[model samples]
Target: MEDSEKNIELKINQISQKLKEIRLSKGYTSYETFAFENELNRVQYWRIESGKNITLKTLLKVLEIHQISLEDFFRNL
Candidate 1:
């Protein structure tokens, strides 16, 4: 893969990791439970947490659900 592709994959992984961290901090050990409680599609949320298909809009929605600003979300990343 190209360097750009590798970087993109790395970023996706980081985002997925961050999402998991947020969920855990929120007292959710299961992604399915988190998705169900948040009214999100479980399968879609799984794919997102797996870093398979994450869009900016979806990310924004998740961040909004957690009441986190884009700046704060990416700050540690």
Candidate 2:
């Protein structure tokens, strides 16, 4: 893949890992529960957690569910 693609992939992985960590730390037992709490479908939540290229709206929603702003999310990294 191109360097840009690789960078985006890495960012996606990092975001996914962060989300997983937050979910686990919050006592979520399953992705399905996480999805339900976030108002998303299980498969859609899986796709986000798997680092698939999701829409910006979906990304924002996930972060919002975690009570994180886009700026804050990246700033802490």
Candidate 3:
């Protein structure tokens, strides 16, 4: 794979990991429960947590639940 591709994949993984950590910290041990409670599409939420098809809209929804902004979402990086 190209270096750029690897870099992108790495970033995706980082974002997924961060989101998972946040979910756990919020007292959700199950992604399904988190999704259901948050009114998110379960499969889409799973995709985001799995580092798959994460869309900006979905990320924004999660950030909203966390009471954070887009800047805060990226502030860790």
Candidate 4:
């Protein structure tokens, strides 16, 4: 793969890891539970945590559910 592609993949992995950590830290043992409670589309959320492509709108919904500000998310990242 090209350097740019590799970098993007690396970033996706990082984001996915962080997302998983946040859910676990919040006492969610299952991503499904988290998604249901947060009114998120379970499939889309799964994709996000799986390091697959997701829309910005969906990501914003996740942040809102977690009460995570964009600033805080980026800072943590």
Candidate 5:
């Protein structure tokens, strides 16, 4: 893969990791529980946490649910 492609993949993985960190910090042991409690699609949330491509709107919504700003979420990433 090209360097750019690799970088993109790395960033996606970071985002996924951050999301998982947030969920765990919030005391959620299961992604399904987090999604269900947030009224999000369980499969979609699972896909997101698995480093799949995500829409900016969906990302923003998820961050909001976690009470975190995009700037904060992406900080030092």
Candidate 6:
């Protein structure tokens, strides 16, 4: 892959790991539980947390459910 593509993939992996960590730290035992509490399906939540090319709207919804602002999310990274 191109250097840029490789970098993007690295970022996605990092983000996915961080998302999982944060969710677990917040006492979410399972992805399904988190999804249900956030009003999303398990599959959809999995895709988002896995950095699977989800839409910005869905990303925003996920962050919103976690009570995290977009700015804070980026700032913390």
Best by lDDT: 1
Model 4 residue 38 CA deviation (Å) reads 1.2
Q: In model 4, where do residues sit more than 4 Å from their true spots?
A: none
Q: Give the top-scoring candidate (TM-score).
A: 5
lDDT of each: 0.94, 0.84, 0.92, 0.87, 0.93, 0.82
Considering TM-score, where higher is better, how would the candidates rank from best to worst?
5, 1, 3, 4, 6, 2
Question: Model 2: per-residue lDDT, tens digit, 1-77?
Answer: 99999998888898888878878888997999989876799998888788886778988888888788889877765
The estimated TM-scores of all candidates read 0.96, 0.84, 0.94, 0.91, 0.97, 0.86
Model 2 lowest lDDT segment of ten = 68-77
Tens digits of lDDT, candidate 6, 1-77: 99999998888777777777778989998999999987897998898778887677887787787788888777766
Predicted structure 1, TM vs. truth: 0.96
Q: Write model 5 residue lDDT over 1-77, tens digit each, in one string.
A: 99999999999999999899999999999999999999999999998999996879889999999999999988888
Poorly placed runs, candidate 6 (over 4 Å): none
Candidate 3 positional error at 48, Å: 0.4
Candidates 2 and 3, the one with greater TM-score = 3
Candidate 1 residue 15 Cα shift, in angstroms, is: 0.4
Q: Native-vs-model 6 lDDT?
A: 0.82
Candidate 5: list runs displaced more than 4 Å: none
Off by over 4 Å in 3: none
Choose 3 or 4, whichever is better by lDDT.
3
Better of 3 and 6 by lDDT: 3
What is the RMSD, in Å, between candidate 5 and the native fold over all Cα? 0.6
